[model samples]
Target: MTTRTSHVDTFARDRLPPPQWQPEFLFELPELQFPDRLNCATELLDRWVAQGQGERLCLQAPGGVRWTYADLQDRANRIAHVLVREMGLVPGNRVLLRAPNNPMMAACWFAVMKAGGIAVATMPLLRAKELGQIIDKAQVSHALCDAALAAELQLAAAQHPVLREIRYFHEETPQGLEAAMARQSPSFDNVHTAADDICLIAFTSGTTGVPKGTMHFHRDVMAVCACWPRHVLKARADDVFIGSPPLAFTFGLGGLLLFPMSIGACSVLLDKASPPMLLEAIPRFGATVLFTAPTSYRAMAAQAGQLRIGAPRGGSLRKCVSAGEALPVATRALWKEHTGIEMIDGIGSTEMLHIFISADEAHARPGATGTVVPGYQACVLDDEGRPVPPGTLGRLAVKGPTGCRYLADERQRQYVQHGWNLTGDAYIVDEDGYFHYQSRTDDLIVSAGYNIAAVEVEDCLLQHPAVAECGVIGVPDEQRGQIVKAFVVLREGHVPSQAMVRELQDFAKRTVAPYKYPRAIEFREQLPRTETGKLQQFKLRSV
Candidate 1:
């Protein structure tokens, strides 16, 4: 376990422009402290909106539009009034928000929180079929959506009558916000909400099958902001959080919205954050901290010099965090190679609400996920629930303030054993106390009477220069029960050949246990990933 900080730059000969002076460094925030009484609704964000109402730069979109903390609170207050007085919505009702990363969407989210309604936010790209399932599961009645995407909801609503009325809010609305803003009062009273009151019902992108709605309390939302954003990133009032993850995903909700608001910091939301869009947005917004997945980091790093994106401008972006999937060691090294900053990788699940374990730059182990976050405890348990010893792999179980409580589903028993939420991941802890992720329990590959971790093989394949992205799984083999199968995406200019396949197969064999080598390989343009950048192994398993 090596943890040292130094500045090193790596760029190819064709990548550099002459030296344009090094950037200055900004002072970082103090170490984190957990709050005793945490609640996302009236306790955390609304309190900040009241105390820091006059702060000018609070929220901004990719278009350079800005809003003060007061502006956001005023709009959210007005929206809350519309929901209560006009729509006849009452406290504890479920109101669905379906929109892109727009200002109104942010306003609606906090407004829903302010009115003591549970907000169920769906991604903008969700189709009718997927949309209907969530609407049905959450029993959502009134949906707030961007006017541009409301027609899709209209079609979805026709299928599910539970979603009777769809409300539209857009920054571009011609009638203006006078009616919308005037509909609510800024002096609205805070509805008394218990800490256990359900504040959100977020659907997990079940890569395996139907999405599961993970119920979270208002306290859990703020609990995550206090534990994760505080301990790992230590976001300050001045830090500007930026990310490519969608707010629909808990990863984005915590990193982009809740975390920033908890600290009175600002956030930059990009409606469409592709590699190129992020390249332009990060520097243009003067983003101080970045939250994205490993895949995006790899893609961004590959083009860093060409796009001029990774360089710190105005000492912004002191921290870069990656989640949603294992951060490839090569990608982490490559990102540090380019930016002179370590890429912090963490594991989080919707059931837990946000990241429970992550590596801070100061405490990072390159290939290993960081130790369990404070206020959380983890154990590796065997099938019989006995704890496994160090250096041995087993199911990862965790117990903490934030735990899984499935929405109207009995499957909760299958995941939560005793007080520990059995995170579906398999991992091994070394004698040194560092934990290394092996693979998801369902993703473990068994071939030729041997157990193999798909992640170990994939991580090895990622080290190969020609391999850009890859997925490893166990495929049915007549002779060997199951065999390793690899789905690879090659680098832009590199073509896969028979020799290249053999070379990658050989590389895995040498880098890992012999049984873990991929006996079969297929080249593809891209590996399927969730909106949060989690690899869809189920999609690969189907093929």
Candidate 2:
């Protein structure tokens, strides 16, 4: 088995999670069955051009920046040649990718995958210290970075001896990626990699602590493309995807890049996407699908009345996907009230690669995230690792074509129990088989005898006009074992006064169970969030 593999640098394969700690994978759908030797880049990029659909736009940006399937494949192929012929990048070498969402960055990702190198993509916003951590952890040898974000990566390369080569893409130098690609042929034969070969080393967001590297196989990449987009999204060839999540994050990698490429659909890349920017671009660029977090959706919903959403001429936003964090019910209602598009909410983790549980526009429920996506099975498990009754709160465990595989981490055992991937989220399987997200298992607030999910209170608070953002946490209390405390960011017109606090407290009391209301509320100018837009509740509690 090892002799037939394509990888010459075996660092990623050597550090994979132990066999006993791995979760079971399910490939029930025929589309999920990939060949023993497959390169996902060929499936996503080359196949479309092979089918004579090369002229179709695959990627688009502002200022008339666009690339057809042929253009992207040519760029990717040339880049792949540059990696093997110029940089001496071995098949399994880890290439660190640091760039904002752009055409060339997408090409670099596909180029690495095509050359059989493990692509270790990182957020461009990461500083030198963070970059060094990933460099040291993944032992990344080569890097393809944007010129704008070169300072930190250069500093990281200087500190980490494992990083032997660093190449800049956007620089207009003789040593830049463009200059190197210009000399190479526009077509190259892709490496024949095993289906189980490590293709991507996606690092976690490290919202809790140090980030862990999650490795994925080539078949796993194609499985995500087949399951979510085919079953839940039902995306069409004419659909154009636009989003705020960075390509470094798996959510963005799937929604903004892979999923779109899988169907020959167009995806718009935004270097920086704010709510106003997305709303304005949707019309100018004719974006039919939007992918962002709950915070961005809440902000855009406030401006929805200012423009006609889903209108072909005025604005085109037919589908909206909400993830990264739990979606607030009030935020969902507000978005629909304004835009008339039911937001598709999903729950996914870095370990799982992309969304495993999601729903479409028609089947979307208000509070429930969704039913188990096709090609997957989910259940709520108690602490003893047994199935819990319906409507019972417990840990959410799922088995699918893609499962958790942390690279050389002890926490791998914690994430995978009973041969199932235990997504640290607390959820309930309803009587109708719908999964309801409550909170993170460790984030549930046990106040007195009542069990309170922090998001439920935060959702109620967001319904009030004054509330812009809020995070609920459990703090020590003398009376109750733990009291629900809220750190809130108010809207521009609302001041942080005792009167406003009382009004919010009373509003929460009226919204859900009285015990679930925040016992104390503190106002802030802003709340701390990870680069991916998930609220940092741990930071809130410390404050």
Clashes of each: 1, 0
Q: Please give the lDDT score at residue 8 for candidate 2.
A: 96
Please list the C-alpha lDDT of all candidates, in the order they appear. 0.73, 0.86
Write down the lDDT that model 1 would get: 0.73
* TM-score for each of the candidates: 0.75, 0.83
lDDT of 1 at 278: 81
Any runs in candidate 2 off by more than 4 Å, and if so which?
1-3, 205-208, 312-314, 443-543
lDDT of 1 by residue, 108-155 (tens): 888887777878998776667667878887778778888777766887
Quality of model 2 by C-alpha lDDT: 0.86
Candidate 2 residues 1-543, lDDT tens each? 233679999988999887778998888899987788988999999999999999999999877898999999999999999999999999999999999999999999999999999999998766676688899989999999999989888888999989998889989999999999999999899999998999999986332335589999999999999998899998899999999989998999999999999999999999988788988888788889998887778778867756877553256788889887777788889888788788899988788999989889889898899989899899999999999999999999999999998888888988999899988889988999989987666665655424466776777799999999998888866434468899999998889999988999998765554657888999988999999999998898776
In candidate 2, what residue range of length 10 has the lowest lDDT sum? 444-453
